[model samples]
Target: MIHHHPDSNMMLEYASGSLNWAHSLVVSAHIQLCPKCAAQMKLLNGIGGTLLAASEPVTAAPTPADSFERLMARIEEDTDASPAAQQVGERQTTAARTRSRKAKRDPIFASVPPVVEKLLSTNPVLPWRRLSKGLKEARLTTGQNRHEVAFHRIAPGSKVAEHDHRGKEITMVLYGSFSDAEGVYSTGDFLVREPGEVHRPTATQNQECLCLSVVEAPVALTGFWGKLINPFLSIRPS
Candidate 1:
Protein backbone atom coordinates (compact mmCIF):
# COMPACT_ATOMS: atom_id res chain seq x y z
CA MET A 1 0.00 0.00 0.00
CA ILE A 2 1.06 3.58 -0.57
CA HIS A 3 2.08 5.17 2.72
CA HIS A 4 2.41 8.83 1.76
CA HIS A 5 0.32 10.93 -0.61
CA PRO A 6 -0.30 14.50 -1.66
CA ASP A 7 -3.89 15.34 -0.66
CA SER A 8 -6.52 16.99 -2.84
CA ASN A 9 -5.23 20.46 -2.05
CA MET A 10 -1.73 19.79 -3.35
CA MET A 11 -3.09 17.64 -6.13
CA LEU A 12 -5.32 20.45 -7.29
CA GLU A 13 -2.41 22.87 -7.28
CA TYR A 14 -0.49 20.41 -9.43
CA ALA A 15 -3.44 19.78 -11.71
CA SER A 16 -3.86 23.52 -12.14
CA GLY A 17 -0.25 23.75 -13.27
CA SER A 18 0.96 25.74 -10.28
CA LEU A 19 3.62 23.50 -8.71
CA ASN A 20 7.35 23.90 -9.35
CA TRP A 21 9.01 21.85 -12.13
CA ALA A 22 11.37 19.84 -9.94
CA HIS A 23 8.45 19.01 -7.69
CA SER A 24 6.39 18.04 -10.72
CA LEU A 25 9.10 15.65 -11.92
CA VAL A 26 8.92 13.73 -8.65
CA VAL A 27 5.17 13.62 -9.09
CA SER A 28 5.58 12.36 -12.66
CA ALA A 29 7.81 9.53 -11.49
CA HIS A 30 5.26 8.70 -8.82
CA ILE A 31 2.38 8.57 -11.29
CA GLN A 32 4.44 6.13 -13.31
CA LEU A 33 4.50 3.90 -10.24
CA CYS A 34 1.19 4.59 -8.49
CA PRO A 35 -2.41 4.08 -9.65
CA LYS A 36 -4.68 5.63 -7.01
CA CYS A 37 -3.37 9.12 -7.68
CA ALA A 38 -3.94 8.61 -11.39
CA ALA A 39 -7.67 8.16 -10.83
CA GLN A 40 -7.75 11.21 -8.61
CA MET A 41 -6.01 13.30 -11.23
CA LYS A 42 -8.52 12.32 -13.88
CA LEU A 43 -11.32 13.42 -11.60
CA LEU A 44 -9.55 16.69 -10.97
CA ASN A 45 -9.14 17.33 -14.70
CA GLY A 46 -12.84 16.75 -15.35
CA ILE A 47 -13.78 19.09 -12.53
CA GLY A 48 -11.41 21.76 -13.80
CA GLY A 49 -12.71 21.54 -17.36
CA THR A 50 -16.27 21.70 -16.14
CA LEU A 51 -15.45 24.80 -14.13
CA LEU A 52 -13.83 26.38 -17.19
CA ALA A 53 -16.79 25.63 -19.40
CA ALA A 54 -19.14 27.15 -16.87
CA SER A 55 -17.26 30.46 -16.97
CA GLU A 56 -17.36 33.02 -19.80
CA PRO A 57 -14.24 33.51 -21.86
CA VAL A 58 -12.18 36.65 -21.32
CA THR A 59 -11.62 39.23 -24.08
CA ALA A 60 -8.58 38.59 -26.24
CA ALA A 61 -5.68 40.99 -25.94
CA PRO A 62 -5.08 43.38 -28.86
CA THR A 63 -2.08 42.75 -31.09
CA PRO A 64 0.72 45.28 -30.96
CA ALA A 65 1.26 47.69 -33.88
CA ASP A 66 3.28 46.18 -36.80
CA SER A 67 3.33 42.79 -34.99
CA PHE A 68 2.11 40.91 -38.05
CA GLU A 69 4.43 42.76 -40.38
CA ARG A 70 7.41 42.15 -38.09
CA LEU A 71 6.56 38.49 -37.89
CA MET A 72 6.39 38.19 -41.68
CA ALA A 73 9.69 40.02 -42.09
CA ARG A 74 11.37 37.74 -39.57
CA ILE A 75 10.12 34.67 -41.41
CA GLU A 76 11.40 35.97 -44.73
CA GLU A 77 14.78 36.82 -43.18
CA ASP A 78 15.02 33.36 -41.72
CA THR A 79 14.38 31.87 -45.13
CA ASP A 80 17.12 34.01 -46.69
CA ALA A 81 19.85 33.55 -44.03
CA SER A 82 22.77 31.17 -44.70
CA PRO A 83 22.49 27.73 -43.05
CA ALA A 84 25.30 28.52 -40.59
CA ALA A 85 23.66 31.81 -39.64
CA GLN A 86 20.31 30.09 -39.38
CA GLN A 87 21.73 27.42 -37.10
CA VAL A 88 23.32 30.00 -34.82
CA GLY A 89 20.17 32.12 -34.90
CA GLU A 90 18.05 29.08 -34.17
CA ARG A 91 20.22 28.25 -31.17
CA GLN A 92 19.99 31.81 -29.90
CA THR A 93 16.23 32.02 -30.38
CA THR A 94 14.14 28.90 -31.04
CA ALA A 95 16.42 26.41 -29.33
CA ALA A 96 16.78 28.54 -26.25
CA ARG A 97 13.05 29.16 -25.98
CA THR A 98 12.19 25.52 -26.58
CA ARG A 99 14.45 24.44 -23.75
CA SER A 100 13.14 27.22 -21.58
CA ARG A 101 9.57 26.20 -22.26
CA LYS A 102 10.23 22.56 -21.46
CA ALA A 103 12.03 23.48 -18.26
CA LYS A 104 9.21 25.80 -17.35
CA ARG A 105 6.66 23.12 -18.12
CA ASP A 106 8.68 20.55 -16.20
CA PRO A 107 7.10 21.44 -12.86
CA ILE A 108 3.54 21.89 -14.05
CA PHE A 109 2.16 18.70 -12.49
CA ALA A 110 -1.37 19.27 -13.74
CA SER A 111 -0.35 17.57 -17.01
CA VAL A 112 0.96 14.51 -15.17
CA PRO A 113 -1.35 11.59 -14.28
CA PRO A 114 -3.10 11.78 -10.89
CA VAL A 115 -1.64 8.86 -8.97
CA VAL A 116 1.93 10.13 -9.29
CA GLU A 117 1.08 13.54 -7.91
CA LYS A 118 -0.29 11.98 -4.73
CA LEU A 119 2.82 9.86 -4.17
CA LEU A 120 5.00 12.91 -4.73
CA SER A 121 3.19 14.81 -2.02
CA THR A 122 3.75 11.74 0.19
CA ASN A 123 6.99 13.15 1.57
CA PRO A 124 7.08 16.93 1.39
CA VAL A 125 10.65 17.60 2.26
CA LEU A 126 12.67 19.10 -0.61
CA PRO A 127 14.83 16.26 -2.08
CA TRP A 128 18.23 14.79 -1.27
CA ARG A 129 21.36 14.21 -3.37
CA ARG A 130 24.09 11.77 -2.31
CA LEU A 131 27.52 13.37 -2.54
CA SER A 132 29.72 10.84 -0.78
CA LYS A 133 30.00 8.56 2.26
CA GLY A 134 27.73 9.56 5.14
CA LEU A 135 26.58 12.66 3.25
CA LYS A 136 23.41 13.51 1.36
CA GLU A 137 22.00 16.76 -0.07
CA ALA A 138 18.99 18.95 -0.99
CA ARG A 139 18.89 21.02 -4.22
CA LEU A 140 16.98 24.23 -4.94
CA THR A 141 15.66 25.45 -8.31
CA THR A 142 16.90 28.85 -9.38
CA GLY A 143 17.25 28.96 -13.17
CA GLN A 144 19.22 26.03 -14.62
CA ASN A 145 18.65 22.52 -16.11
CA ARG A 146 15.20 23.24 -17.53
CA HIS A 147 14.52 19.60 -18.54
CA GLU A 148 17.10 17.14 -17.19
CA VAL A 149 16.53 14.89 -14.11
CA ALA A 150 18.70 12.74 -11.85
CA PHE A 151 18.44 10.45 -8.79
CA HIS A 152 20.58 8.46 -6.38
CA ARG A 153 20.93 4.76 -5.48
CA ILE A 154 22.22 3.97 -2.02
CA ALA A 155 23.37 0.49 -1.11
CA PRO A 156 22.13 -0.84 2.20
CA GLY A 157 24.30 0.46 5.03
CA SER A 158 25.72 3.10 2.74
CA LYS A 159 25.90 6.85 3.40
CA VAL A 160 27.07 9.92 1.51
CA ALA A 161 29.48 12.70 2.45
CA GLU A 162 28.38 16.28 3.12
CA HIS A 163 27.21 18.55 0.27
CA ASP A 164 24.84 21.36 -0.70
CA HIS A 165 22.16 21.36 -3.36
CA ARG A 166 22.27 23.83 -6.23
CA GLY A 167 18.51 23.25 -6.64
CA LYS A 168 15.46 21.34 -5.29
CA GLU A 169 15.71 17.61 -4.35
CA ILE A 170 12.81 15.15 -4.67
CA THR A 171 13.32 11.46 -3.96
CA MET A 172 10.98 8.42 -3.99
CA VAL A 173 11.96 4.92 -2.99
CA LEU A 174 11.76 2.06 -5.48
CA TYR A 175 12.76 -0.64 -2.97
CA GLY A 176 13.90 -1.15 0.65
CA SER A 177 14.20 1.57 3.29
CA PHE A 178 16.73 4.04 4.72
CA SER A 179 17.06 6.40 7.62
CA ASP A 180 19.11 9.18 9.02
CA ALA A 181 19.29 10.43 12.59
CA GLU A 182 15.90 12.06 11.94
CA GLY A 183 13.69 9.03 11.11
CA VAL A 184 13.22 5.90 9.01
CA TYR A 185 11.92 5.84 5.39
CA SER A 186 10.99 2.69 3.52
CA THR A 187 9.88 1.60 0.09
CA GLY A 188 7.17 3.77 -1.51
CA ASP A 189 8.25 6.57 0.82
CA PHE A 190 9.05 10.04 -0.51
CA LEU A 191 11.30 12.79 0.80
CA VAL A 192 11.57 16.46 -0.22
CA ARG A 193 14.51 18.07 1.54
CA GLU A 194 14.23 21.81 1.16
CA PRO A 195 17.11 24.05 0.25
CA GLY A 196 19.88 24.68 2.88
CA GLU A 197 19.14 21.67 5.12
CA VAL A 198 22.03 19.21 5.30
CA HIS A 199 21.93 15.57 6.40
CA ARG A 200 23.46 12.17 5.67
CA PRO A 201 21.20 9.22 4.79
CA THR A 202 21.90 5.48 5.20
CA ALA A 203 20.00 2.54 3.75
CA THR A 204 19.36 -0.77 5.51
CA GLN A 205 20.53 -4.14 4.19
CA ASN A 206 17.05 -5.60 3.92
CA GLN A 207 16.97 -4.69 0.23
CA GLU A 208 18.50 -2.43 -2.39
CA CYS A 209 16.86 1.01 -2.77
CA LEU A 210 16.01 2.99 -5.87
CA CYS A 211 14.89 6.63 -5.75
CA LEU A 212 13.38 8.75 -8.54
CA SER A 213 14.47 12.37 -8.21
CA VAL A 214 14.84 15.63 -10.18
CA VAL A 215 16.80 18.86 -9.70
CA GLU A 216 16.89 22.30 -11.31
CA ALA A 217 20.55 23.08 -10.77
CA PRO A 218 23.93 21.46 -10.11
CA VAL A 219 25.01 20.27 -6.61
CA ALA A 220 28.16 21.44 -4.88
CA LEU A 221 30.18 18.98 -2.75
CA THR A 222 31.95 20.22 0.38
CA GLY A 223 34.85 17.87 1.03
CA PHE A 224 38.11 17.92 -0.98
CA TRP A 225 37.67 14.49 -2.60
CA GLY A 226 34.00 15.13 -3.16
CA LYS A 227 34.73 18.44 -4.85
CA LEU A 228 37.09 16.64 -7.23
CA ILE A 229 34.21 14.44 -8.39
CA ASN A 230 31.82 17.40 -8.67
CA PRO A 231 32.43 18.01 -12.36
CA PHE A 232 31.73 14.38 -13.27
CA LEU A 233 28.61 14.15 -11.12
CA SER A 234 27.42 17.71 -11.49
CA ILE A 235 24.01 17.83 -13.16
CA ARG A 236 23.21 20.75 -15.44
CA PRO A 237 19.61 21.77 -16.01
CA SER A 238 18.13 20.43 -19.23
Candidate 2:
Protein backbone atom coordinates (compact mmCIF):
# COMPACT_ATOMS: atom_id res chain seq x y z
CA MET A 1 0.00 0.00 0.00
CA ILE A 2 1.12 3.54 -0.76
CA HIS A 3 1.35 5.82 2.26
CA HIS A 4 2.82 8.85 0.48
CA HIS A 5 1.27 10.55 -2.53
CA PRO A 6 1.39 13.72 -4.59
CA ASP A 7 -0.65 16.49 -3.00
CA SER A 8 -4.06 17.46 -4.33
CA ASN A 9 -2.67 20.54 -6.12
CA MET A 10 -0.12 18.44 -7.99
CA MET A 11 -2.79 15.90 -9.01
CA LEU A 12 -5.04 18.73 -10.21
CA GLU A 13 -2.19 20.13 -12.30
CA TYR A 14 -1.57 16.69 -13.77
CA ALA A 15 -5.27 16.30 -14.65
CA SER A 16 -5.30 19.75 -16.27
CA GLY A 17 -2.17 18.93 -18.33
CA SER A 18 -0.26 21.79 -16.68
CA LEU A 19 2.70 19.78 -15.39
CA ASN A 20 5.91 19.40 -17.40
CA TRP A 21 6.29 16.14 -19.36
CA ALA A 22 8.87 14.56 -17.02
CA HIS A 23 6.85 15.29 -13.86
CA SER A 24 3.68 14.10 -15.57
CA LEU A 25 5.38 10.83 -16.50
CA VAL A 26 6.39 10.14 -12.87
CA VAL A 27 2.88 10.93 -11.60
CA SER A 28 1.33 8.78 -14.32
CA ALA A 29 3.50 5.80 -13.34
CA HIS A 30 2.54 6.25 -9.68
CA ILE A 31 -1.17 6.55 -10.50
CA GLN A 32 -0.97 3.23 -12.33
CA LEU A 33 0.32 1.56 -9.13
CA CYS A 34 -1.66 3.46 -6.51
CA PRO A 35 -5.45 2.98 -6.46
CA LYS A 36 -6.04 6.00 -4.21
CA CYS A 37 -4.17 8.34 -6.52
CA ALA A 38 -5.82 6.78 -9.55
CA ALA A 39 -9.29 7.51 -8.10
CA GLN A 40 -8.23 11.06 -7.24
CA MET A 41 -6.96 11.59 -10.80
CA LYS A 42 -10.30 10.39 -12.18
CA LEU A 43 -12.16 12.84 -9.96
CA LEU A 44 -9.91 15.72 -11.03
CA ASN A 45 -10.35 14.83 -14.70
CA GLY A 46 -14.11 14.80 -14.31
CA ILE A 47 -14.04 18.22 -12.66
CA GLY A 48 -11.81 19.61 -15.40
CA GLY A 49 -14.04 18.22 -18.15
CA THR A 50 -17.10 19.72 -16.54
CA LEU A 51 -15.48 23.13 -16.22
CA LEU A 52 -14.34 23.02 -19.87
CA ALA A 53 -17.82 22.07 -21.07
CA ALA A 54 -19.48 24.87 -19.07
CA SER A 55 -17.09 27.53 -20.38
CA GLU A 56 -18.04 29.58 -23.46
CA PRO A 57 -16.20 28.70 -26.66
CA VAL A 58 -14.16 31.47 -28.20
CA THR A 59 -14.86 32.46 -31.84
CA ALA A 60 -12.08 31.51 -34.22
CA ALA A 61 -11.24 32.53 -37.79
CA PRO A 62 -11.71 29.98 -40.57
CA THR A 63 -8.70 28.42 -42.35
CA PRO A 64 -8.01 28.82 -46.07
CA ALA A 65 -9.41 26.18 -48.49
CA ASP A 66 -5.88 25.05 -49.52
CA SER A 67 -4.73 24.60 -45.90
CA PHE A 68 -7.90 22.71 -44.94
CA GLU A 69 -7.51 20.45 -47.99
CA ARG A 70 -3.87 19.68 -47.12
CA LEU A 71 -4.81 18.81 -43.50
CA MET A 72 -7.58 16.44 -44.67
CA ALA A 73 -5.25 14.81 -47.20
CA ARG A 74 -2.57 14.23 -44.51
CA ILE A 75 -5.13 12.68 -42.14
CA GLU A 76 -6.37 10.36 -44.91
CA GLU A 77 -2.82 9.28 -45.73
CA ASP A 78 -2.17 8.38 -42.07
CA THR A 79 -5.13 5.94 -41.93
CA ASP A 80 -4.13 2.23 -41.95
CA ALA A 81 -6.09 0.96 -44.93
CA SER A 82 -3.53 -1.15 -46.85
CA PRO A 83 -2.85 -4.87 -46.23
CA ALA A 84 0.92 -4.18 -45.97
CA ALA A 85 0.32 -1.65 -43.16
CA GLN A 86 -1.90 -4.14 -41.35
CA GLN A 87 0.82 -6.80 -41.56
CA VAL A 88 3.44 -4.39 -40.13
CA GLY A 89 1.10 -3.48 -37.27
CA GLU A 90 0.54 -7.17 -36.44
CA ARG A 91 4.32 -7.83 -36.34
CA GLN A 92 4.90 -4.84 -34.07
CA THR A 93 2.13 -5.98 -31.73
CA THR A 94 3.65 -9.46 -31.54
CA ALA A 95 7.10 -8.05 -30.73
CA ALA A 96 5.58 -5.86 -27.98
CA ARG A 97 3.81 -8.86 -26.43
CA THR A 98 7.08 -10.82 -26.43
CA ARG A 99 8.84 -7.99 -24.63
CA SER A 100 6.01 -7.71 -22.12
CA ARG A 101 6.27 -11.39 -21.28
CA LYS A 102 10.02 -11.10 -20.80
CA ALA A 103 9.55 -8.10 -18.51
CA LYS A 104 7.13 -10.05 -16.35
CA ARG A 105 9.78 -12.73 -15.88
CA ASP A 106 12.43 -10.23 -14.75
CA PRO A 107 12.36 -9.40 -11.03
CA ILE A 108 13.48 -5.78 -11.51
CA PHE A 109 10.65 -4.92 -13.90
CA ALA A 110 7.90 -7.18 -12.50
CA SER A 111 6.27 -4.36 -10.47
CA VAL A 112 6.78 -1.53 -12.97
CA PRO A 113 3.71 -0.02 -14.60
CA PRO A 114 3.21 -0.05 -18.38
CA VAL A 115 4.16 3.65 -18.61
CA VAL A 116 7.61 3.02 -17.09
CA GLU A 117 7.96 -0.39 -18.70
CA LYS A 118 7.58 1.11 -22.19
CA LEU A 119 10.40 3.56 -21.46
CA LEU A 120 12.65 0.84 -20.00
CA SER A 121 11.99 -1.48 -22.95
CA THR A 122 13.46 1.09 -25.34
CA ASN A 123 16.96 0.29 -24.00
CA PRO A 124 16.76 -3.24 -22.65
CA VAL A 125 20.46 -4.05 -22.91
CA LEU A 126 21.85 -0.88 -21.36
CA PRO A 127 23.73 -1.43 -18.12
CA TRP A 128 23.35 0.56 -14.94
CA ARG A 129 26.26 2.93 -14.23
CA ARG A 130 27.91 3.11 -10.81
CA LEU A 131 27.29 6.40 -9.00
CA SER A 132 29.07 5.18 -5.85
CA LYS A 133 30.12 1.93 -4.15
CA GLY A 134 26.60 0.60 -3.54
CA LEU A 135 24.51 3.03 -5.59
CA LYS A 136 23.84 2.85 -9.32
CA GLU A 137 21.94 5.13 -11.68
CA ALA A 138 20.31 4.96 -15.11
CA ARG A 139 19.15 8.14 -16.77
CA LEU A 140 15.86 8.27 -18.67
CA THR A 141 16.09 11.03 -21.26
CA THR A 142 12.77 12.86 -21.72
CA GLY A 143 14.13 15.93 -23.59
CA GLN A 144 12.81 18.23 -20.91
CA ASN A 145 14.45 21.26 -19.27
CA ARG A 146 15.50 21.35 -15.58
CA HIS A 147 13.87 18.03 -14.71
CA GLU A 148 16.28 15.06 -14.58
CA VAL A 149 14.49 11.73 -14.63
CA ALA A 150 16.38 8.59 -13.65
CA PHE A 151 16.38 5.31 -11.76
CA HIS A 152 18.47 5.18 -8.57
CA ARG A 153 19.25 1.68 -7.40
CA ILE A 154 20.59 1.25 -3.88
CA ALA A 155 22.11 -1.95 -2.64
CA PRO A 156 21.02 -3.50 0.64
CA GLY A 157 22.23 -1.63 3.77
CA SER A 158 23.68 1.21 1.69
CA LYS A 159 23.10 4.91 2.18
CA VAL A 160 23.00 7.61 -0.46
CA ALA A 161 25.01 10.80 0.03
CA GLU A 162 23.36 13.27 2.37
CA HIS A 163 21.86 16.16 0.41
CA ASP A 164 19.49 19.08 0.40
CA HIS A 165 17.28 19.95 -2.56
CA ARG A 166 17.75 23.14 -4.55
CA GLY A 167 14.34 22.74 -6.16
CA LYS A 168 11.59 20.14 -6.13
CA GLU A 169 12.40 16.44 -6.15
CA ILE A 170 9.83 13.68 -6.53
CA THR A 171 10.80 10.07 -5.88
CA MET A 172 8.59 7.02 -6.32
CA VAL A 173 9.72 3.70 -4.90
CA LEU A 174 9.56 1.16 -7.73
CA TYR A 175 11.02 -1.77 -5.75
CA GLY A 176 12.07 -2.65 -2.21
CA SER A 177 12.14 -0.02 0.56
CA PHE A 178 14.26 2.81 1.99
CA SER A 179 14.35 5.07 5.03
CA ASP A 180 15.54 8.57 5.87
CA ALA A 181 15.23 11.19 8.61
CA GLU A 182 11.66 11.92 7.51
CA GLY A 183 10.28 8.38 7.28
CA VAL A 184 10.56 4.91 5.80
CA TYR A 185 9.13 4.46 2.31
CA SER A 186 8.16 1.23 0.63
CA THR A 187 7.11 0.31 -2.89
CA GLY A 188 4.59 2.67 -4.52
CA ASP A 189 5.28 5.47 -2.00
CA PHE A 190 5.50 8.94 -3.50
CA LEU A 191 7.98 11.29 -1.75
CA VAL A 192 8.34 14.97 -2.53
CA ARG A 193 11.34 16.88 -1.25
CA GLU A 194 11.20 20.63 -1.53
CA PRO A 195 14.05 23.12 -1.41
CA GLY A 196 16.27 22.99 1.68
CA GLU A 197 15.02 19.57 2.83
CA VAL A 198 18.04 17.45 3.74
CA HIS A 199 18.14 13.70 4.32
CA ARG A 200 20.12 10.58 3.53
CA PRO A 201 18.19 7.57 2.26
CA THR A 202 19.33 4.02 3.04
CA ALA A 203 17.94 0.83 1.60
CA THR A 204 16.81 -1.93 3.97
CA GLN A 205 19.12 -4.88 4.60
CA ASN A 206 16.94 -7.56 3.01
CA GLN A 207 16.66 -6.27 -0.56
CA GLU A 208 17.98 -3.69 -2.99
CA CYS A 209 15.88 -0.56 -3.56
CA LEU A 210 15.01 0.97 -6.91
CA CYS A 211 13.38 4.38 -7.18
CA LEU A 212 12.20 6.54 -10.07
CA SER A 213 13.24 10.12 -9.38
CA VAL A 214 12.43 13.43 -11.10
CA VAL A 215 14.40 16.48 -9.97
CA GLU A 216 13.79 20.06 -11.00
CA ALA A 217 17.31 21.15 -10.02
CA PRO A 218 20.53 19.48 -8.97
CA VAL A 219 20.79 18.56 -5.28
CA ALA A 220 23.49 20.06 -3.06
CA LEU A 221 25.19 17.52 -0.86
CA THR A 222 25.82 18.36 2.79
CA GLY A 223 28.67 17.57 5.26
CA PHE A 224 32.44 17.57 4.64
CA TRP A 225 32.73 14.54 2.34
CA GLY A 226 29.54 15.42 0.49
CA LYS A 227 30.75 19.01 0.01
CA LEU A 228 34.01 17.71 -1.43
CA ILE A 229 32.14 15.72 -4.08
CA ASN A 230 29.30 18.19 -4.61
CA PRO A 231 30.67 19.53 -7.90
CA PHE A 232 30.87 16.09 -9.48
CA LEU A 233 27.47 15.09 -8.02
CA SER A 234 25.48 17.91 -9.58
CA ILE A 235 22.95 16.37 -11.97
CA ARG A 236 22.69 18.73 -14.92
CA PRO A 237 19.82 18.93 -17.37
CA SER A 238 20.27 16.66 -20.36
Name the best candidate (by TM-score). Answer: 2
Instruction: Name the lDDT value of residue 58 in candidate 1.
Output: 87
- 2, model 2: CA deviation in Å? 0.8
lDDT of 1 by residue, 1-238 (tens): 5666655666787677666555655665565656788788889989999998999998755332133234334444533344566677665676565345446532422333333333333323547765555334444332324634444666667865566776666667655667766677765666666566666667786545556566555556677976687788656553
The alpha-carbon lDDT assigned to residue 177 of candidate 1 equals 69
C-alpha lDDT score of every prediction, in listed order: 0.57, 0.79
Worst 10 residues of 1 by lDDT: 108-117
Residue ranges of candidate 2 with Cα displaced over 4 Å: 58-97, 100-106
For every model shown, what is its TM-score relative to the native structure? 0.54, 0.81
